[model samples]
Target chain A: MLHMLEKTIADNPLITAFAFVGVVIWVSNQIGRHLTGGRVAGSAIAVLGGLALAYWGGAVTGKAKGLADIATFSGLALMGGAMMRDFTIVATASEVHVDEAKKAGWLGVIALLLGTVLPFIIGVLVAWSFGYTDPIALTTIGAGAVTYIVGPVTGAAIGASSDVMALSIATGVVKAIMVMVFTPVFARFMGLSTPQSAMVFGGLAGTVSGVSAGLAATDRKLVPYGALVATFHTGLGCLLGPSVLYLAVKAITW
Target chain B: MVIFGTALLAACYLAGIWVGEAIAVLIGVKANVGGVGIAMIFLIAAQHFLKTKGLFPADTEKGVTFWAMMYIPVVVAMAATQNVVVAIKGGPIALLSAVGSFLLCFGVVALINRSMQRHASPEEADASAALASAPDALKSR
Candidate 1:
């Protein structure tokens, strides 16, 4: 019986992968509810947990893909690929109403611009302070401050080294974690009760996962509003990062 | 009906990918032009169209929402499993930059919000509270 079950899991890697993630999410949710009283979102905890697991997996397998490096877990690579990510991102459209989203108006647009530019400049300056003076590295790290997805996309576009790209991604991840943990704590101070404020907040924050989780913790209704605007930051950042931002950085440094 | 709904999603996604690629090509870049973003725009436009035409179904939206919520946890998992080893090996600079940039962003955003609040009226705050207190389901719809 045990051998047959093991063989089945080995043969159907995708199913096994799903099962593994299911358990992790369940455990994370339980931890969130019981320990944190839902103060911290389960998704944030789960993501953090998954990172720890990935680290352990990498150390054990001497592979970069984490648990996906294992034979049975290889399906996770496909499950977590760009296709699924895009599908999920698209799926969010079903919940959004164009007319309703427009309530935030021009202020929302200004916030989005500020969100992208401010983070990028800060990221570049920090990188410079850290002794990364190369234009490509600075731009990549700065773009990563825009969002994790933008970081890798910008890195690939500007011909940044893999290590530099990874740094950019890490920078974005740290930002996301901070947003997730602190948004609720600071919600009142920031006047985050309304949809308008939420939209502006999302636009300024720029990281979808972070803003969504943060807003979710502060107020569930605000998540959709914030995420709607935050979603645009990725596209805008990607559009500007490699070409305009890269050139501006080169002009400054070179 | 579920199959049709799924197909609708796939069609929009494929079209979005095509548009993204076309944009990338036009810009002389060698990557997809925010395929996810384009896909989202397509999905939103299509959903509105379907609703206006009275062809949108609750079940279909429910199915999409299920996938959408599922995607959230996937995002979290993806973050945790990212290439931290390479990032760490890149050194203390990356870590410092992340911390520094985050602090700066928080400060600037807070300042902006506070300035906005200085001019915001009590009625606006009341209205915001009322909106926030509305039923979650109706608000989502």
Candidate 2:
């Protein structure tokens, strides 16, 4: 019977993958709500948990794809693939209404630009400080500081190495976790009280999950407002990171 | 009808990937650049077009919501796809870049708020004060 169970799970990889992930999310959510009292977003905890599992999988199998390298979890390869990842991002964007987005006005625009460039500059400086003088590496790492999606996207476009690209993603994930944990703590202090302020905050923060989760915890009403501007950071960062920023870094570092 | 929304998502995704690939090739890059971001823009534009055409009823929206519900799972799945251990062990570069950028960004936010406070009119300040008391009012849907 145990052999049959393993065979069944191994044969239906996608099904097993969904079930496994669902359980992980459920447990993560419980932990977020109970353990951290919702200060830390459940999603952040889940991501950290996923990273740990991936590290464990690497240690266990001495191979990549994290836990999916294990036979029963192999469906994770498909479930976690680019297809599902992009599909989820598209769906999240569908929630934004054009009219609601228009409320951000010029302030949000400035915040968005400042948010993207500020992070990139800081990221580049840090990368430089860490002795990453290669223009591609600096830009990629800096872009990753903009957002995780943007980081990997920029790194891939600029022909960064696998190591640098992975660091870019990790850096972005760390930024997301930072936004998640800090938004509520600084909400009132930062004057994140109005829809417009939420929009500006989102623009400054520049991570959909981070801004949305932070705002949701701070004020469920502000989720859409903050998320609206934060959503654009992905495209804006992607557009700017590998092109303008890359050139700027090369010129300065050259 | 809801399935149609799912199909729309898939359609936008494929289109986004196509455009992303095209952009990558144009830029002499060997990989997709903004596929995910472009796909998002496509979804938003396509959905808006459908709504303007009165074709995107609430039922179709449900299909989109189904994928939305799977968000947490997919995010975990996506995060799992990357190998963080290898990245972090590469050095302190990743952690430092993230933390440094984050601190600066947070400080900028605080500075922006302070600047805005100085520039705010009395009525605007009163509005912010009122907003602080009643957050639910911000839900301008």
**Top TM-score prediction, candidate number:** 2
TM-score of each candidate structure, all chains considered together = 0.82, 0.87
lDDT of 2 at A131: 73
**Chain A of model 2 scored by TM-score:** 0.87
TM-score of chain B of 2: 0.77
Off by over 4 Å in 2: A133-136, A156-163, A216-221, A242-254, B122-141
**Over the stretch B1-141, how does candidate 1's per-residue lDDT look in tens digits?**
566667777888889778867877897765565565566678778888988998988877766777766675565445544555566666566566667666666666677777777888988777566545433331331
Looking at model 2, the pairs that clash are none
What is the lDDT for A64 in model 2? 57
> RMSD of candidate 2 to the true fold?
3.4
lDDT of 1 at A216: 84
Give the best candidate by lDDT: 2
* lDDT tens digits, residue span A108-202, model 2: 78999999999899888888887789999898889989988777667766777755766787788888888888888888778876766787788
Candidate 1 per-residue lDDT, tens place, A38-151, comes to 656676567667666766767778777766777777767667665676676667566666665565568778988888888889889888887888998999999988887677
Model 2 preserves the real interface contacts to a fraction of 0.57
